[model samples]
Target: MSHHTLPRPGASVFVYEWPVRLWHWANALFILVLIVSGWFIARPLPTMQIGEATHQFVMGYIRFAHFAAGQLLTVGFLGRIYWAFVGNHHARQAFYLPLWQKSWWRDVLHEARWYAFLESRPGIHVGHNPLAQIAMFLFMVVGMTFMIVTGFALYAEGAQRGSLPDQLFGWLHDALGNSQLMHSLHHLGMYFVVIFMTAHIYLAIREDIMSRQTMVSTMINGYRSFKDDDAA
Candidate 1:
């Protein structure tokens, strides 16, 4: 027990509540849908020569799916933000950095060492560790914001002059001055989300297998259980 520090690991901990878990699974589904539909929109399939353009409504369907997924993502993001305010302290973690706190950095360094294989065990955390928190803030929080803003702005372009999307994000048109630049940035944001998703999945699987604590199943069940009494 002496080795155990923050978030003593002898027993199970309710790390994520139902709201968090529900949002997580829904968000994951929406992201998957968005990625596939977004790809079709950005680089569409070759045109079919059998019929007129009006008969080939594939591109229209793809765009509609993309737009619907984007709306779901926006709604999920806003819901997650609301949860961060009224939910537990764990809920609020990924929203900010503890830059002014020395101990937090020390914990981050400790986690880094663990990742580098310099440490034998990982620090037990009911919520996200400092390093994980930073990743979440950067990729999930910031990345979501970038994707939503740019996506809506682009949507506003097709939505014509006075639609709601245009009304809200019309200023982006004047700021970017050109549609190509906006498209480029939005493409980059999607890539960022893809890369982040890859890393997040790998880490979750690795931690679930290697560490004494639960990882992959934690979000599924909303519980974090430790295999050992002493935490790293």
Candidate 2:
């Protein structure tokens, strides 16, 4: 997922570093928790009359996990943004798009063709391909910011005015005007994240099967080994 196809000969290259690998896994786990708990909160399970009021807190625990995961996601994201500045060039790929470059857009189209089965081979690069870069920029970066802001804004309501969440995210209420709309948008954001995650996993698997380099394993161990000598 990180290294380029060999420019010269056969050997593995280290691409993702420890921080990136660690954050990738942690962020993924946090997102999973958020989605699962968020859904239950939105459409709660049926109440059990068999239990006394003091004996159970099923919904309460679900809401707590949702809130906890949201906080973790926010913190992890902020640290990731910091890594974009301090980490390797590959680490910064998701933070911005190369919209001004014509060749970049051409390669993006090439990637599209590769996915569509129109191209015989996909190109390999040191970092993300152009298409993946743009998708990450828009979906992960921008979409994530949207989710974090709206989520905290909703949390701020429960925290009451003048609390830290309110002070930090209160502007979202001013911009959106209605709490229900914010809730709806946050719910929609979950679907967007799920869609992206599905596509990301599929593309990783497809590339692992078709490409010259290690795809999924590269993220896990921070190195990418080429499977072919053909120039990517």
lDDT of 1: 0.86
Number of backbone clashes in candidate 1: 0
Model 1 Cα lDDT, one tens digit per residue, 14-68: 8898888898899899999998998888899887675887677888899999999
- Any runs in candidate 1 off by more than 4 Å, and if so which? 1-10, 49-51, 229-232
What's model 1's TM-score? 0.93
Models, CA RMSD each: 2.3, 2.1
lDDT of 2: 0.86
lDDT tens per residue, model 2, 116-162:
89998777665677888888898899999999999999999999999
Clashing pairs in 1: none
